[model samples]
Structures are given as C-alpha cells and as structure tokens.
Target: MISTDNFTIDSTKSKAAAAERFINLRQQKKVKEFLVKQRGYKRPDFNRMILDLSRLKWTHEKIAFVLPVAGASTVSELARGGIPNFEHGEALIELWKSETRVDRVPREGEWQTYKYEIGQLELL
Candidate 1:
C-alpha cells in the first residue's frame, strides 16, 4: 500500500510546477491569436516609438485619443518598456509619420538608441 504521509515535498519541483501553471493562465489572457499573428511587434521597435514621441512632446492624452490601447496611467510604463497592444503601435506609427513627415518605422539596425554609454566613464 502507498502511504501518503511518506512523501516529502520538493521545493524546486513545486516552484517549477507553480511557474508553469502561472504561465498557462497568463497565456489565456493574451490578445487574440489571429490578431497577434497579423499585427505583433518587436519590443525594441515599440520602445523607440515611445521615446521619439515623448521627445516630440506627444502626450498620452493625444495617443489615447487616437487609440484606446495607450492610457494615461501606462505612459511611463510603455515609455520605459513598450506598449504591448498592436493597435497602439499602429496609431502611434501614423502620428509619428504625420508629425515628423517621415514615412518609416525604425529598422532593427536603426533602432540603436545610444552610441555611447555614460556609465562606461569613471565617476569624477
């Protein structure tokens, strides 16, 4: 007979199981599969858009007006990382093109934000 009391919980295995479950739950909440397939984006591209728009003094209010994907509360978060929603990226692309009079998105190579790092220099 198998005894239930004889088994010991392995913490590493337990943590791994928990992480897998959490990932599954998160995946369920992701944007629609077909939509994501059609309009997904790379992280760096979104980051560049946020930075450029911010420098151009485009407010969250303006962005949200065009697409509900960007909200005021998430402006800093999106700027620091990215707006995950494809709709927001599309709207921002339009805004950038019209305001900057440029009809292009940053390419993988052109997404290089900074040439040199201030942190590399020794502190005075």
Candidate 2:
C-alpha cells in the first residue's frame, strides 16, 4: 500500500514552477514577429535611418519628441541599432525628409554674402 501521510506540497516549488511556465509562455509569443509582419522596418534599415538623422543633428530627445510612441530611451535604442515598429519607422522617415528639404531658395542677398565669404577665403 502507498503511504500518503508524509507527502506534502511545497508552495515555493509550486510558485517557482508557475513563474517558469509563465515566462515560457511569454517567450513563445514574440510581439516583434507580429510587428515585422505588419511592415516594421528591419534593424539594419532602421539603424541606418537613425544614423542619417543623427548626422543632421537630430538628437534622441528631438526624435522622441516627434514620435508619439517613443521616449528618449526608445529613441536612443533605435539610434543604437534597435528596430522600430512600422508607425514609428514611417514617422522617423517623414521627419528626416522634412528636415532634409531646403524650405526656400537662397535669395540674392544670401548668394552675395556667400560669394563675399568665398572671395575672402580665396584671398588667404
């Protein structure tokens, strides 16, 4: 006959097991995959875009300000090669495009100033 008198459940062990199970379930559901499937930018492209924006003097804070879904930390991560979700990626690209444009043509006054500066440099 089996003895059941000494058998007891360990609450700590059961709790640990439950936690492990939860973690495993979470790991199996990769949200990044879903985001990618929904047209998120790849890591490389995202990183390149971030770098380009940085070259134009766009700081992490500045980017985060423009992207509704991102904070400074998120912007920093994205700048350091992290991939952005579809919406954020598209917004970043649009921000880059807007910043890259010359808002207006340089007038004659601006051209004359530039020409004078160049002439002064040539005299050196």
Candidate 3:
C-alpha cells in the first residue's frame, strides 16, 4: 500500500513538472512573437523625432541636457534640419524610443495636467 501511494505521488509530481514546462515554453513562444512584431517597426527620422519631442513640450536645452551632443545649440541646429553625427543620431533615437512608449504621450494641453498629477503623487 505504501509503495502504491509513493507511486501515485511521483506520478502527480511528474505531471506537475510537465505542466510547468509546457507553460514556460508557451511563454517563450509568446515573447518571440512579440519581438518579431517589434522588429517590423521602423524608427522615425531624426527630423521627425525632434518635431515629435517638441510637440511633447520638450525644449532644445532639455534635450541637450539628456543627449551626449555638444550643447543646446547643436540640438537647435538638428531641429532646424541639420544632420547629426552617427553617435548623436543614435542617442536621439534611443531617447525618442524611451520617451514615446505607446499611450504615454499626452495631447497638447494634457502634459501640464499630467505633470501636476505626477508631482502631487510624488509629494506623498
């Protein structure tokens, strides 16, 4: 009887392990599909990126502070349609991607309201 009980317990354990493995494999497949979809997305050009950032209420000085570029003047020049060096261009692209996640950007007048709400939350 004891041997039978042990066998049943071992069988249950094996089933649970198999189920966990299946779940993990499914999750990995889903992640791969998500990555494939993301890869199909084309990044915006530097000019459009600068324009979008401006629409989001970002100033050239603020962008310069975050970027590895020379200064605010460099950012302003880029905004005016000057091409950036490879390094600066990559940095701007990265910044644009990080800041422009889906549904996180605010409409024209909503940015200040969102900022105020964030500030209020931080006060706590």
Query: Arrange candidates by TM-score, highest first: which order?
Result: 3, 1, 2
lDDT score, candidate 3: 0.69
What's the true lDDT of residue 30 in model 3? 100
Q: Candidate 3 on 1-124: residue-level lDDT in tens? A: 1257346356677789999999999999999999999876643346656766776778889999999988989998887768788889878877876766533433333433543123123210
Worst 10 residues of 2 by lDDT: 115-124
Q: What digit string (tens of lDDT, one per residue) describes model 1 on residues 75-124?
A: 55666664456766677677766655555566344554434222233111
Query: Which order, best to worst by lDDT?
Result: 3, 2, 1
* TM values, all candidates: 0.45, 0.43, 0.45
Model 1 clash tally, residue pairs: 0
lDDT of 1 at 12: 81
Please list the Cα RMSD from the true structure of every candidate, rounded to 1 decimal place.
13.8, 15.5, 11.9
- Candidate 2's clash total is 0
lDDT of 3 at 46: 64
lDDT (CA) for every model shown?
A: 0.60, 0.61, 0.69
Query: Alpha carbon lDDT of residue 54, candidate 2?
Result: 71
What are the per-residue Cα lDDT tens digits for candidate 2 across 4-66? 688877778888999999998787677756776867332334554565567667787888898
Model 2 lDDT on a 0 to 1 scale? 0.61
lDDT of 1: 0.60
The residue pairs found clashing in candidate 1 are none
Kindly report which residue stretches of model 2 are placed more than 4 angstroms away from their true locations once superposed.
1-44, 101-124
Among all windows of 10 consecutive residues in model 1, the one with the lowest summed lDDT is: 115-124
